[model samples]
Target chain A: MGRPSAGKSTLASHVEDQLVEAGYPIENLDGDDIRKHLHPDLGFSREDRRTNNRRTAYIAKLLNRNDIPVIVGMITPFRDSQEQARDIIEDEGEFVQIYVKCSVEAAEERDPKGLYQQAREKNIEKFTGVNHPFQEPLNPEIIVDTEAQSIDDCVDDVMTQLETLGVLDERLDDDYSFSITRSEEQDITERLEELGYLEE
Target chain B: MGRPSAGKSTLASHVEDQLVEAGYPIENLDGDDIRKHLHPDLGFSREDRRTNNRRTAYIAKLLNRNDIPVIVGMITPFRDSQEQARDIIEDEGEFVQIYVKCSVEAAEERDPKGLYQQAREKNIEKFTGVNHPFQEPLNPEIIVDTEAQSIDDCVDDVMTQLETLGVLDERLDDDYSFSITRSEEQDITERLEELGYLEE
Candidate 1:
């Protein structure tokens, strides 16, 4: 969890891709994508933010229940909210909070949406570290400083952490091999038919 | 949006049943089910609640995009989140915000989870009305008073609203028939086998 344009989404997506490549069933819950698709009715107020946070955590928990490790990327600005998320998951130490730290200067330079510039120009209000307050993480399990670190380095750090946690194992390799032989294409077509997307 | 134990889930399930029975593809996104299955890590804090609301909306929008009307039951306490959800769907008036309006007394009386009793005993903090705030809808599309109205009445009201909103074509007879050819099942089975779910 970090401010917008902090490379949180990028980092999480990279990690998800790596995990997928390593043959683990994974889901990346990106905040923006979710906002557009899931909770379009909510706004960026304090109350709305809390609701958004809770919903995302609930999705992560669901994926976890399905034995899928979910990598979530959101501008979760509150420590209390994060703690609440951990409590909801109930699977102790499974919820890894990775703080993608970056300086305001660096974030401004890398503002893909030009949001920081808009915030500075007073075109956007309540921008994190500008008009809105961003509560820094007191003690996140992992910290990746986007200002100094390369994407590859950040990915490597996350991969190393996953290995240390023993979340990935030889079973993943076996699953990949098994999946290649399994008929996934047939399953997709059958599912499509069951949903009435296809006819006789 | 209303308090937990306010019959939100029960009502949504009923509505979904009616829609499906009317030959419409329906999906129900219940808060409890989502928390248990999708977002195991999320809790019921202000921020967390907002996130939850947003995520539900996102899923609803996705279903809507696929021409499926999703019925979601959540304690969305804030209006901003609801508005955001509308924006995400982009289709004007597609989001039917049915405020399951019920008094705290009524909710407590129907306390299926014993949550209200706990809240009254101060065992739980941030209990919708007992501890936390619940913003009443200023202009909800439909208001179902569970305390005064019968389940049948409530269901009828929703069905009428859906019809009025053109969600259900009233002209279509209740006994409208569609041919269910056995060959369709054979085709689906063949597709499933191709997908590798069935043995060749």
Candidate 2:
């Protein structure tokens, strides 16, 4: 979780693509995507923000429980809301909270969505790190300082954390090592093409 | 989807359990559960109901895109919202609209959540089928008449629909015939026990 323009969605999508390349099926749950499709009526009120975070958390937990890892990118500003999500998801699967740290000034200068300008101009209400406060996570599993690191480096940091947590490269046993073979890759590609999910 | 006490959750959960038993990992998106955990700020307003339905549909689409089938049980009172859900999900995966049909009288009589009585006594506002309207689907993929059929029969009807849609028991080609055998089951059970998800 991080402020706007901190590259949360970019990092999450990068991780999802890398996981797919590693033969792991994963899903990208972006805050903007969820808001566009799921909770269009939700405003930026505190209650609405909490509800949206909880919504994303519930979907992530469901996907994780089904053996599909999910990369969630959201501005989970409230500590309580983030903790609530952790409590719910950690019951079924691991909840690795990654704090994408960036200064408000840096985020405003980046202005990825122009949201910071809107908040600065008083055009938007309850904007995180602008008008509203964003409580930093006290105990995040990983912290990638966006101001000091490139996007690739930040993604590498997250991947390293996941590896340490035994999420990626989970070797079952010496006798049961698993890896994607050339034929399996070809089969997956063929299936994707047949399903119209990809072009031949 | 049907009225508040139309037994949608029970039916959906049963179907999910059956799918698990059939070696398919599935997720059940329940209206009440989502309201409790995800959409706590949502009320019975028409806009809120539409947002909730769209929210569930988005999550279902995400899960389905990740190769996990989803069974959604929501009192989707608006035809436009249902159509919107179909449009969103059908783009990625199959969208089977199951209209669980039951009489308003029967639903009120069941009063599963005691909500029907509240609606009848004017204690609840914007209650679907009482204070508000529940627009029936113009062309649902399947219709299970809860008033006429037993729960088992209703589930059977849904299973048959899925089978006809080629969603269930899809024994893949010989080249990729994947199934969990007895030893695999034992291994999985042992892993779950070790992970403290099952009794030791």
Candidate 3:
């Protein structure tokens, strides 16, 4: 869980691809998919945000009960909502809170969906980190500063943290293609963001 | 899937318990639970029923992709919705259509939730099997006549069919407690039904 445009979805998707290639039973509950499919009725209000977090955590619990680990990228702006999600998911399996940290200035500058622009210009109601507050994580198990690192670096940080937490076996680790930095990696990633990829 | 009061939820719950006892990776998405948790905004209209069916099938697909079989007991009252669900789930794994057959007369006679009474006397709008139509399964993999047989027999039939489909290994099969016809079985089942256990 992190702030809006904190590189949560981009990093989560890459980490999921890396783990899946190693034959791990893992799923990526991408924020875009969740918003389009599950909670279309939810708004950006604080209570609605809490409801969304609680619902996503319930889905994670459902998958975890079957021994399938899940990666969810949600902009949980409330401390109470994050705690509720942790309590819900930890009942079935481990709830690893990874804080993708990005400052307001950096996030606004890298506004993939133009949400920040709308929030600033039109003054969208209940916009996180703009009109509403974005509470920092209380005790995150892992922290990836996206403002200081590239997307690949952020994903690698999460993967390494998962290994340290014993969620991934070291023997199965290898040179994942996503880890190798290339010109196409940086170029296409920027283009994809413009096309509204990983805007969550 | 089956019509309302067709013993779908009760039989599915029993089958889930039996399979889980044998250490099978299976999950039961009971109808009442689904209604209470996921789609409370949905009404008893035809389009809403189809939406509910589609959503449940997507969840089954998510679990099936991770190699966890799901048992969903929903009142899919439209043929197109059932086909849509099958198409969604088949993309991940085998989709078994279980038709719990019970006549409207029998179901009304055994109405546990007084829904039939309300539909007949007070005229609840869009009630399936009353005002709304419940399209019969076109080609169900397994059909259990709940009106003719007991709930234990219905569950046993599904288990046998699953084994025939090779979804369950013969070596792991055993005499489950749910299969045993104790006095508590019939008595408790009836009592629970009155308490709105399988009203779905």
TM-score of each: 0.50, 0.80, 0.77
lDDT tens per residue, model 3, B1-200: 88789888899889989887756778999877877766677787887787788878888898998878899988898999989998999998889999999999999998899899999986688878888899998999999999999999888888878877766752333434233333334477689999998687
lDDT against the true structure, per candidate, is: 0.75, 0.83, 0.82
The DockQ scores of all candidates, in the order shown, are: 0.21, 0.66, 0.37
Model 1: fraction of native contacts: 0.40
Docking class of 2: medium
Against the true structure, whose TM-score is highest?
2
The best-first sequence of candidates by lDDT reads: 2, 3, 1
Candidate 2 per-residue lDDT over residues A1-200, each given as its tens digit? 99889889888988887677766778888889888877777788898898889878888898998888888899999999999999989978888899999998998899977888888889998889878879999999999998999999987888777877666654222223765343345588789999999964
**Residue B91 displacement (Å), model 1:** 17
Give model 2's DockQ, 2 decimals. 0.66
TM-score of chain A of 1: 0.82
Top DockQ prediction, candidate number = 2
Top model number, lDDT: 2
User: In angstroms, how far off is B128's CA in candidate 2?
Assistant: 3.0
- lDDT tens digits, residue span A1-200, model 3: 77788889888888888877756778899877877777576787777777778778878889998889899998888888888889988898888999999999999999999999998986687788888999999899999999999888888888778767766642233434333333234477689999998587
* Model 3: lDDT of residue B72: 92
